[model samples]
Target: MLASRFGAAAVAIMCAASAPAFADDTLKKLGQFQSTGAPGEIPQVEQGGKKAENLRAIAPKIKVPDGFKVELYAIVPDARHMAVGTNVGVVFVGTRKTKAWAVTDRDGDDVADEVKEFAPSIKKSNPNGMCFTPDGFLYMAEHNRVLLFPAAEFFYESPDVAVEVIAEQLIPKAEESFNHGARACVVGPDDKLYIPLGQPFNVPPKDKLPLYDEQGMSGIIRMDRDGKNREVFALGVRNSVGLAFNPKNGELWFTDNQVDGMGDDIPPGELNRATKAGQNFGFPWYGGGMVRTKEYQGEQPPADAVKPEIEFAAHAADLGMRFYTGEQFPEKYRGGIFVAEHGSWNRKKPVGARIMFVTLKADGSADKAEVFADGWLDDKTGRYLGRPVDVAVALDGSLLVSDDLSGAIWRISYKD
Candidate 1:
């Protein structure tokens, strides 16, 4: 059933990506499919009923810092990553699954009223990470390809929106893994799309490193907005789910999920800063933060495996993050960062179903990191009420947190 729905785009992607001639033929067919979709016709998600109430009930348990509070914004199932629209403040959410959603508050009330699938006719596979360019083009980085939607916000009301396949075959078919395959992308200050491709295995063999590196399967790769001139931007990443360019200095910052099975506490997760392209963050050799992986213990890591800006608790599963450019919050948070820790799944004692506030110094280095909101995990029973996957800042200065575990988008705002 799943394949029946998303099969066309996926099939086109695989075929078109094999060669340029085939690409033109298959992708054109897909675009023809795109333009024929019914206008002003959108399939909607069931917004009201028990699910929304249950999600709202969990909001009271969400403990925020003083002067801030969180409320249920919208019910967005499998919300993994988010990008606010360039013109109308619509929030486009991507998922690890085939579906992506467009959420709108519609009234500037800080609560989304409509939640609907984006490009419902496209049927792309795992259109997971989404980023909007300054000029209004939206990039959706899928498992094996990257797509561009021009005027995504304006055209989103219709299924017949103009679309382009920016890049093809992000990873070879044999090398792609369902694990760690949710890609995260962003339009950098340089007008390029930076996409992080996670290595599939817990720890890959040494012999495969060169192939992975050549394809940027274990690192971040960037290309021109139109998907031209592609090149690897950084390397040695295990699985980076979050990518943000600091508005202060245009440096890229991302959160990396450390390797698992190294015990719950041995390999810490990372929050890295890429001041320049081609930097490496240790992965197979060092699971995270210098804790070498047993798979490559005897081998030498890259000579310049740059250290992360901040090392998070082991197995915290840090995911989406964004710099705080909103004035709704106090001065301390205005120029800082907010990150969503999806929390650890297999830790002996669970930790990190929370949002973190990291204050940065004048030089763009992190000065401190602390929990800004939590209580998603029941301390008494270890049950998770919600697991946050991404953080997005709104036009009104509110913070939107996407929770796949709870199937909701939460709005966090501050009042003096």
Candidate 2:
């Protein structure tokens, strides 16, 4: 397919031609993605009854393409759409409501035991972005800063303390209307931290019909590992609560929440690929590649504005994303991306609440999208059995999902 698109010889030539620019652009996007502290992971969780915290039984019933099986990998308490990490073989996850971090060791044998907490509490702050670096140090992203603790101290409290503040004092003041407190961060290819500082509110235009640009308070920011070198990569983005580096192209991808109160199906949510730094993605000016309605008149972006890779249904509230790199799934999905739809609240009718896949083409556009897992939200009564927040690859080549609504972790694997 790639050869057909770019030609057999053109692949090499084009790669050579684009390599330098791609690398430079990739570095900029990486810094932009991690400018905050650490980006969070979303787990697509079931919304039914208050189920028991068991990783084994929760794995099944997840719908997937052929040749795939789902199972419970680990059970976590109050698991939000935050990040997770593994070292040697231990798996760790961060949470928000409980202000705690948990870990489980799932070796290649498909068994996860020794469930425990890595960090106790952060006191009045949300716990997100618990991940590892190319080095061995484990990192966690709180609301306004990133904290690092020794890996050995994960099992037991260690007297050897090495806590460093990578990023601090973010967005001292924001628009009074926005509800964006979910800032996620990750390390970029340049070894610097990229963090997302979200916008302030769900705004409307000045007068009413034909939406206009409502700028300020919402954008993707970049910073160094030590919290220096801060800059805005793109503006007008409402909020990218989750971010992930595309394993195939090394580009940064994010899920943006469309502004609400625009009806259930207008101005759908978006899955955006950050191809260049300082690229403006249509936010208040436009949504889902179409102009939206607003209360006040505003300036619209030029026709040259970058469009989204994929536009989800209105109010889907797409969040965390993970590129599938496991061996358990079929070959077709080996290099695809999985996104978690946390569902929406302000809409008259709720949408999302499932795990979906973005099938990428050689040109990097999403050719099509389909649900990898469903049964989360009910269409008949508008009730939800589960709410998916983030997706992650487990040690055994299975997929793990976190549910903030139910505070549970689910595992989906293949067995054929």
Candidate 3:
């Protein structure tokens, strides 16, 4: 029944729409059948309605520093990375699931007035990365392709907005893995589109090292807006899901989820900085800086393998991050980094499920890291109420955090 509906709906929509004929193949492949149903038909792991009501009941329990308050901004299923629309004040959210959402607040109220799917006509697989170029173009990086929606903020509600494939065949269709396939993208200060391609293994298999290194897998790559001049910008990273360019120095910063199965506390997750192009951050050779993995224990690390700027708690699962350039917060938060730790699944005692702040010194080096907001994980019950996946600063200077577990976006604001 699910496949029938999916296939019929897809065929009908394709026939009614003006999209290219090749989109049929893409939609068919994305609809690969499973025992449960079509992959796209799988209900979002987190949902709205009853789940959202429960989440709202716990919203007041969330903890933040003094003078700060947390409120439910919107209910968006499977919200991952977020990009705020420049002209329309719409917050665009990407997801590992089929749909991407655009959230809006038409009135002056901080809460959202409407949350709707963006570009329902387009078929996307693991469209987890979303960003807006400085010139206002919105780009979405999916598992195997990248898309550009020109003037997306203006025409998101329309069913016939133009969609261009900027890049495709990013990872070979045959080599696609169920794990670490969701990507993250950012428009860097250089005006290039930067994307991180995670190698598919806890520690990449030795047999695949050459192919991974040559193709910039397990690292970050950049290309022009037209998808030309593709080149490896950084290498030797392990499943980095977050990328942010500092507004002050334009350097790249990211969160690297370290290898698992090494006990709860052996290797730590990392928050790293890359000051220049072609630099490598140690991965298989040294898992999360200095903790050698058994797979590559005897191997030698690259001479220039850079270390992380700060080491987070092991199994924290640090994912999305951003540099705070907003003025709504206190003066002390200016130029600091806000990271979303999505929490842990395998640990005996789960950690993270909160936001962290990392302050930078005058010299542009990290000074300290501390929790900015928490209480998502109840200490008494050891269960998580929400898992934060991404952070974004709204145009009004408020901080927005996307929680995938609870299917909600939270607004963190400050008042004197």
State which candidate has the highest lDDT.
Answer: 1
Better of 1 and 3 by lDDT: 1
Q: Between candidates 1 and 2, which one is better according to TM-score?
A: 1
Order by TM-score, highest first:
1, 3, 2
The stretch of ten residues in a row with the least summed lDDT in candidate 2 is: 1-10
Error of 3 at 170 (Å): 1.3
Query: Per-candidate RMSD vs. true structure?
Result: 6.2, 11.3, 7.4
Which parts of model 2 are misplaced by more than 4 Å?
A: 1-61, 106-111, 121-124, 150-161, 173-178, 204-216, 293-297
Question: Candidates' TM-scores?
Answer: 0.91, 0.78, 0.88
Considering only N, C-alpha and C atoms within 3 Å, which residue pairs clash in candidate 3? Answer: none
Please list all clashing residue pairs in model 1, or write none if there are none: none
Ranking by lDDT: 1, 3, 2
The models' CA-based lDDT, in order, is 0.84, 0.61, 0.83
Residue 54 lDDT, candidate 1, scale 0-100 = 91
Per-residue CA lDDT of candidate 1, range 55-138, in tens? Answer: 889998999988888899999988889999856899999998988999987887777889988888777888889998775667
lDDT for model 3, please. Answer: 0.83
104-124: candidate 3 lDDT, tens digit per residue: 888969988778787666778
User: Candidate 3: where are CA atoms >4 Å away?
Assistant: 1-52
